[model samples]
Target chain A: MPNADGYVRTGRGSPPVRTPTPRSRRRGVASAAALLVTAGTLAACGSDDGGASSLTWYTNPDAGGQAEIASRCTEEAGGAYTISTSVLPRESSQQREQLVRRLAAEDSSIDIISLDPPYIPEFAEAGFLAPVPDDVAERVTQDVVQSAIDGSTWNDQLVAVPFWANTQLLWYKKSVAEAAGLDMEEPVTWEQLVQAAEDQDTQIAAQGIRAEALTVWVNALIESAGGHIIEETADDPADIKLGLESDAASAAAEVMKSVSSVGGPAFTTAGEDANVTDFEEGDASFMVNWPFVWGRALGAVEAGTLDASVPDDYGWAQYPRVLEDEESRPPYGGINLVVGAYSENVEAAYAAAECIASPENQAYYFISNGNPASNSTVYDDPEVIDVFPQAPVILESLENAAPRPLTVYYSEVSGALQRIYHPATAVDPETGPRASELISSVLAGEQLL
Target chain B: MSTTTLPPTKKTEPVSAPRGGLSDRSKAERRLGWRLAGPAFVVMLAVTAYPILQAVYESLFSYRLTDPDNRSFTGLSNYWVILTDSLWWESIAVTVFITVVTVSVELVLGFGLAMVMAKALKSIRPVVRAAILIPYAVITVVSAFAWQFAFDINTGFVNSWFAWLPGVSADTDWFGDKWLSLLVICLAEIWKTTPFISLLLLAGLAQVPDVLQEAAQVDGATWWQRLWRVTIPNMKAAIMVALLFRSLDAFRVFDSIFIMTGGANGTESVSFLAYRQTIARLEIGLGSAVSVLLFIAVVLIAVGFIKGFKVDLSQARGE
Candidate 1:
């Protein structure tokens, strides 16, 4: 059993004891020293040149809009700084992971970060973000949507600058709405949409895939029912109080259960993109998605991939309500700008972030990239209205939307919720309690998810 | 003749150290051997042992990467939390299920493929082997995406192509149900890795002597009898090696599940759970605990294969 002996020896033997002759040992030590030197050099290579006037903005994947804005902000800086854009991964979670790892190492190359709203609290809590100067905070928050402002703030301080705000709208086909006799002019409830879908023999597409998108859907449902996912967040993880056991949670669960039946056959796996595809080519007549769906549909029509009649029949309204009498709070999403605390050029980065988020640049971003602007003033831009006909509804949704729970342990809470409330058809009255227990245990370090 | 054989057998006898220690020449040879292997040993320690030891150390603390201020020495509580959690056990069960099913299926399929490749015409052997190895050549992530798209209801033709079969329709969602999702994930794993198993088995098949089959046939044995009693017994080492490698590989299944379902509908593997904890949740302590446990499980599996199955790897290597 020499092979077994080899395995055991390798597993247990200390490497330092293996040196034999003095001459060879000396050579080995020298080589090891050389290797250490090389590793040190490699580690040192990760830092940038620390150019006094250069700032790097880590932006989420988009259609060159962030890069364009970087160039614009650089030009506007009047030689104060030159901003360069580096794209993060497409998925928000990947973006968070990359940024978190680099920030944990105190990497100074990241001067600016286009952060997702849900992760802003985590980054801010970690001290990975530079403090927002009082003047910068005031200017950035001015005229910004309330949800965006709320999303950008942590611990009662503006931790990040609100860049663009996104909210879902109830998109419906006019023909289907008329056929189901459902009025599209007013806000509708989830029950009404399900009923209409059932009556019309069509689908209501919502994000049910097990991802952050699902968390957004779950958060919106709970918020619309007037419940916060975390009733009280504490400095200690164990002290966090979850609102999942509340009546509002049950109501949200009930709505999810009801809606799942009309959410198409592949409802459990339908993400935003799948829902869009279903809406255009399949039986999905109603969907709750970001305003990008409009651009996608029009783009498809222009490319001759879709019939022009689809966009012609499109109608948008406020997000669906969980309860008939209460107003719906849509899910708030988008990018916010955070300057790295380790950045040598923090001031320049802040200035560039402000320029990138200006109403004029925001309007340009909205019109060009199909991302909504956080500044409410951008909605009134005539060119914006020309590009996105549902600009008013989007602005209203953004104003009324509720951002996901703000907490340092957001990923754990969201992961737990996504695990328990998934495959929406399985959600029942008891689902909320189960999810609450899981989240509580996870937060307390008593459970794994 | 007896004296000549005695001298040769004495010459073959294992060398024993002199009264107390190795002779000077033997010591010098040993030193030379160590010096030759020194660099590789150091490289392995730096790359493998250091990180694993770091994980073991980190597993003793309650640390979240995002909250450096609150890190505390929790001792074995992280291990306790994971050991008592249902999600951990459920993921273990899922991982074991995938490993068992995929490895067993791939073994039988790979054996069949090996037989085909081994018995194919000499002129066309390369073509057959190349065709069979194509899936193995494709990257795992790319293959996972291809399989995911194939099973996706919106973008896939699988539902439409199989609509004629009972219970499968254009509306069939492969990733919607736990069992169905696991089935798809296992299918992807088996498809991408069976070629590797087959290639290994093909080497094993080539090592089996043709004379034994002919001799068995000459002795009035049936084809099945020859295969069972002669071919299989002679290739037992090969089979064991193939099973051991494939089982270990299958146990760490992550890429397909990550790409296809994102571990939805209870398809989470232990590796996926570790990733979710460490990368997604940023709980370094908890994730390291998961990793240490996974490492232990892998070692246990390897040990089991070696001890319980008496898999003599030396023999497999033709020593």
Candidate 2:
């Protein structure tokens, strides 16, 4: 290249040299790198702004749902917030795991958590959730049934808002009882109930039907029997007494095994369906179920689609009295709604929770969802009375319902019981030694406790 | 490509060449390698690295799912609690048991099927292969449910068939019973995962030389003898790859147990228990500890594969 104007063609000397100095060039590179880094950092921090700050509602999506209750609520409160509703899997195990991972991850994205009451203590204790507002707690403490509150409170603090009640109830077929030649006037003692089912077993079996009843419904029977699942011992804070191997437990277990004969030619009378479906078919003479069965089973019964497998003369029992001790009463517990401590908008979340737990919503839960109301105040009210003709019974069931031991090892305990229940592990029916041994192994609590 | 090269360039360049010693590459070329890998690297770091770091940090605390005042940094206590606990060991035992049973079964069946398919009539191969895939094609949950229903009393087809039994004709609650549940899960897993294994082995089978088998036969070796000597020796690399793949998958089992028994009835694997603690109990610290332990187990198992099976993971695996 040559210089301009009067310059002749030549090398560097003829060229106008304007390359940046090494120092200037280094500065330019450093400044550009700094700009990029700053921009990146800003981008990273700004991620919380868009499509976030909007509150998320994790719940099951209803088929007929407005489908955007969260968004609607947030909108009604003005543009200050946007609420996003995420439909999470409703399976019990799945729900529990997702909640744990989110909180463990320190996920600030989720501000509201709908907790099942049995799980409330764990979340609250782990500091994943904030305390309920004092006013809300005080009011809920009064309005909510004590049984529901018992499960939701951890360390004497209100950790969740009671969504609705789930009190166990006796569900028997009114019509099937008639066919089985039974009177449905009053609840039968465990023995009498078995006898009555035995009376009609032949006929039921001949028709290819089987009678069924709950084996785990001992809590109610415990209260009625004067036994308890766990008794708080005044003797020691470190001690919780379980009557699992006690006479009460044996009595309950005997009752469960005895009841399996109801519609059976044999063990075929018992299956996983003993929990729910056994009573769905019109042939079973009796069943014990919670309120959810009302919508799923009774609705079919009322609609005439199901033959109302429960006896024509239905029987209701809170739980059959197991040990008959005055102090041993069955406990009631279910799920509850909680606000996450990591949630940014605590007040908004609180308000949302309050709305969800309102008496009207409680009624809706009873009528539509087949869940009993957590609020005791709504029980005798004319509205709930219509929704659940058995509402009075459920209310009574709440006063002295049993709650599972809220220990960290509760799952392990339940799992142990389930394992022992498996026939292979269960001792020979002729002798329960093996089953007893397994239960003892479970009770030994080496790993989980 | 350059078999005959020029004579070696005798010390043309000094040993300590300037910083720019090699090729005169452009800045873009220098950066292209990193840029090409940048997205995947960033993604890998975000997905795998951050969670692991966070889990390791959380493993020091003793947090309870049902209690709040209980959440505190216990400084390695959570790990101690898990490691020292008998529950952890039992779960690990169960996990190993399930993994070994299922993976070993799958390997044998898969290899057998692969061998058969490799030598079967060409016209029937496609049909047989498709039939094998039908099981793997079925969703895990669906397969579990099907097994649950078939073996179930009250409604299962198994019970109806059992009615014809000499004495135990009643509905026995097939999977609800211990040992039985494990057996059912093992069967389902074998059925579902065997095809994937077989397909891999089939690829390996493609590489085995027909001439090698003929040479073995020329020595008057029977089918079993020839298979054990010639075929298996040749397929060692593929078998190793398949074993490693299936065993790792089986170790982290969750779906079948979750659906069939919810970790009840002695079917709980380490992952299922971890899930229960993390989700059901809402104990973040404990759950994270469990997770860290799981990752360690996986690492150990991976090393075992390398050492035990003589796997060269640096090369392609489970191809």
Candidate 3:
């Protein structure tokens, strides 16, 4: 039973005392004086030097993984610029919040930015995105995914381009496909994948082995089945056009439930670690993730910590097309960069973005981090093909992937669905009613965005 | 000098003293005292009062941080939306629940620790106190990570040990379970904050005279009886201070829940909800409305507490 004084004092980096004596008094004065001195020094350090070529870039893309790519750009640009970068700690929603705060503060030091998708619209709407010159926007439009442009578009203005694009693609292990006695070359229907997953489970189990078929998947079920998580208008939420009421939507949920009931459980909360953890741990033989996981997971599998053959010995396919008659459409899941509409140095920022969008720099990003190009033509590049063999197959998914609805109330609308149809609504009993009610409310403008 | 001496004898002249009474000081001295402390006062005003005022001002308009230009006056509209929303009300309930549960648990745990420490032998007291403080000593992020790892599905130690417990499965995912995840967050908070409360109580306990306890024991009063009548009444003032501080801190908790559950699993606290709306959804006007509401709530609480306890706080502190 010691005094809690020590603990409290430690937070302040001092010991508890009744009051300051002459000796302690001196220490306090000296510290204050030192702080003032430090402040003065910092002020002097912040004075304009006028000609520094250090470019500060904000990104959370592989964080440290973007360095070599940046260095190469600086080198190719003849060292007129030295790239410095900071990684945003949060992704998507959280990142947008952090960025807004920074921009509102109007910091002069932020020379460059890397915005995530979904953020592009807000920034673009707020006019925070810097407008790229016609020439630059033209070059960018050619190389990046069309979906990537959505974040950068506002009133027909091009504000940013894709550093790398992320489109969710289907990844199935070769052994698992063979075990299920399914043909990889054949197009997979949602029903076919479900059937194959179970059959594969049985074949593997016949040898006293175990594997989960019908592990969790997104895009395929959500958008393909015509579920609309985002609404374009701020109206009565009750009229939301979420595809929950559609036949495909119900079918996807019911099919997912059936697959789970037959011993093919969805991915548990082992923390998908961006899907790699799910696949590499053998909990799933396939998953939907952006391209980067491929590069990092490659080492683990090769080292035998993971099933090495899972990488090369696999099949990549675009998300299955929904039944033609169904209303759901594929929604693209990827990253996009937009100009900070509030930036004073719009031209400089645009120039930097152009540098990143340059074919060589884009290739550098692809080589270092395995980021896929948004540029449609880059899929056909020999160098790109050699680096990412799955690129060609994944490209098809991008073309079909739909943009999440663009609306200010997108968060509220999406949140409603997330709440109603949690666990993919695939197996949850109350989800059908909940999702139906939520979607109805959204459509009616009585629910949310 | 001779005339003044004569006059002083006649009037029995007052002698000068080292320290003067209030009347002896000039207006300049009083003004100087206020001046010496002025910078700090102004700083506090800027840092605190300004933000509060800003929140109020923002609440009066449709303030969007992203769309700075569109922050036009839309008086009371945001407030109207929040008050009418059932989801907003649910957040209010969740925020209250977290605050009540966390503060109550911390108070009890902290008191128990304080009691143990207060009675320990001088030589061993420091060690025991330090041991009790180990939880609070860890940084919040590290502590959060520790709890998160303990509950991690694949590598978490809780899963590893769960099979040893009766009737529980090894593979149950703790993070996905709503109430369970919230409980984990609460536990993390209690573990971190208990020491702070205990220390405050311990300081209060030290001021209770030992003579009263001895007299009670001589009168054949049991320990519980002595504590209730003699110790606790003596500790009341300290307890109030600790309670107010703890209550305020707990009411706005956001970090642990955010880290552990990502505010998912149906545990959206008011602060987290505000964050999601303002930052995540770019609903700045709504966020400002929440901030203004929170400010008013705190003010009302303070006023209520003061009215309920008619005794002057300064006088109690002095005693």
Candidate 4:
């Protein structure tokens, strides 16, 4: 029998060995040609003419502040480099996922990245970031708040340029504070806030949701109690030590439990935005939130969604204390700039990053975008003060704030902490030891989170 | 048609011919079949088998996406770690609970919907079907978000609307407790996917011969009796198929739980756990192990449905 391809079967129940026919050979050639065409098309799609002067900055989603800075810095470069902004996802975890995946693949198109502080250590440890030159580092770090500087450093090296810094403040209703007889001039403890909320027949709004916000609140509480979430860091994941099973951790847990009791009925589901809404309209009188709450309130008032008297009664203070004698270490957050290691225009990227993080640009970004500047000088800017009446308190909070635990295994540690200490009302004295074990085991690869 | 060109097998050589071996003409047909299906087979392998095989290969190592260079062979320790952990078991229990509840409830509700659609007046059948399918057509994530917003304490109307009910108030947090969160997630899943089950069951309902039901009616059988004796027995294959697909889908639930609670308050499914390990934590090895386990679980569920129900797909297709 002859097949369609002109191969002949010599006999039954036996495989035939024959020379390839012209038609069969033509089919092979056709397939090979098709393969070549596909390969060529894909290769063409992969390459781009993004020249040495073109830089792509991967930025976390903001209200056009980063894009404005990119354009300003591009003009200042004067043909050295033209910076273009690529907006990443809104969530920090998603941004890290995007940049990390690209950097892992050695994608040179990622010239500059706006990285969250918590993930900076991971990127630096993985050698995904280019080393910050001493001159650039010195210029960017000068006059920057210590917390931002600390957040940007890994292994004692300044791995990222501090762009903007963020910290939580104790936002309280002035009427509630006065009615409870709590001194608005002094720093209050979590104990005091819980007491005042109970006395005023109101609620305390804190982020107890089992997400990164929960991790931030937990870290701030522990740090304010004079302990680090990660007591010691090591190259080996197994050797790292956690500070959860300590007196400070117990105190932090105690404060969390007390505050959660006074937390509104939806406390466990409340994130920063939810807390802001609660503070605006609900029974929540005291909230620990980012500086955006003030901006949000004023914007709501201006938009006619909120009464103007609400903004007049808004009061801002430093983050609540965990202990009477110790100063509160508010949660530090914000974006920092890093140059991708694979970027061909490394020098240009660094220049662009430094230009973007300059005090003047930082002040502009602060005033325009409502993001706090990392440079202390920006807090003293008249426009900044005029825009953010809480500028001084924000600066103070940023100075004393503590970044989340710096570890290459940050996700694992934070995941464990969030899991074990969530729904603040469920947190107990045993939570500290349990979280320590979970973090240690997860880091050591002996357990799953 | 081409078999006419093939040489005939000899009847005298029956002893030499292997019992299961194909004759010349059938062998030729199979060769042609392979030639025709070769591209599809290779494409399926490339798109599906390659990644699953890759996952299995990577599951043997201690790999992190960020620190790829430090990956080392660890055999099956990742699986061992997961199997031993309480968290994995808790997530598994949650997944099973969701699967059982959602599939069972959907089976009943979907049957009701299928009956309505199947027996509706012909003029209104399309409208009824389309309206029923609107939830199914909406993206799962969008539906999940809508459901979350509807139940959210701060922004949701559920609290206020149900304020007069027991344990309901202006401050009721639907996502605050483990069971409550799972309840909301299940509600979202059921609302979004019941239409799919009903559609499948409707097709099954069509396959039940009308004459049999008419005969049962003429024999003075009640509607309930006729349904159990004729309708259900005839549509067994369709029901089995619907159950299989829905159970497998519900077992792998990720989007609703992810959007609603972010796996918080102990609502994490196995798929969500895998996502967290892979994307969030970057634990490639552990995540792959979880994925491989989930794949096995899905296969087992499919096999169980097929075997337990004795479903003949050919019969389901009305062959």
- My TM-score estimates for the predictions, one after another, are 0.91, 0.71, 0.83, 0.90
- Runs with alpha carbons beyond 4 Å of true place in candidate 1: A1-52, B1-11, B14-29
Comparing 3 with 4 on TM-score, the higher-scoring candidate is 4
The per-residue C-alpha lDDT of model 2 at residue B131 equals: 76
The residue-by-residue lDDT of candidate 3 on B27-140, one tens digit each, is 667788899999999999999999888777777776556567756787887777778777777777777887789889988888999999999999999899988877776777
Residue-by-residue lDDT tens digits, candidate 4, A119-180: 99999988999999999999999999999999999999999999999999999999989999
Interface RMSD of 2: 24.2
Best by TM-score: 1
CAPRI tier of model 3: incorrect
lDDT tens string, model 3, A275-360?
45556555566555555557766656556666655666656766544443553234454455555555545665666667777666
Instruction: Give each prediction's DockQ, rounded to 2 decimals.
Output: 0.36, 0.17, 0.19, 0.31
- Candidate 1, residues A1-449: lDDT per residue as tens digits? 00011101111211322447999989989999999999999878744445547888998877778899888888887878898888887688889999999999999889999999999988988899999999999999999999999999999999999999999999999999999999878779999899999998999999999989999999999999999999999988888999999999999999889889888789999888888888888589999998888888888898899999989999999999998899999999999999999998898889899999999999988998899999998888999999999999999899899999999888889999999999799999999999999998888888888
| 1 or 4, greater by DockQ | 1
- Please write out the lDDT profile of model 1 over residues B162-281, one tens digit for every residue: 999999998898999999999989999999999999988887777777877777778888877877887777787889999999988998899889988899988999999999889988
What i-RMS does each candidate reach, in Å? 10.9, 24.2, 7.3, 16.8
lDDT minimum window of 10 residues, candidate 4 chain B: B1-10
lDDT at A297, model 4: 76
Arranged by TM-score with the best first, the candidates are 1, 4, 3, 2
Error of 2 at B302 (Å): 4.9
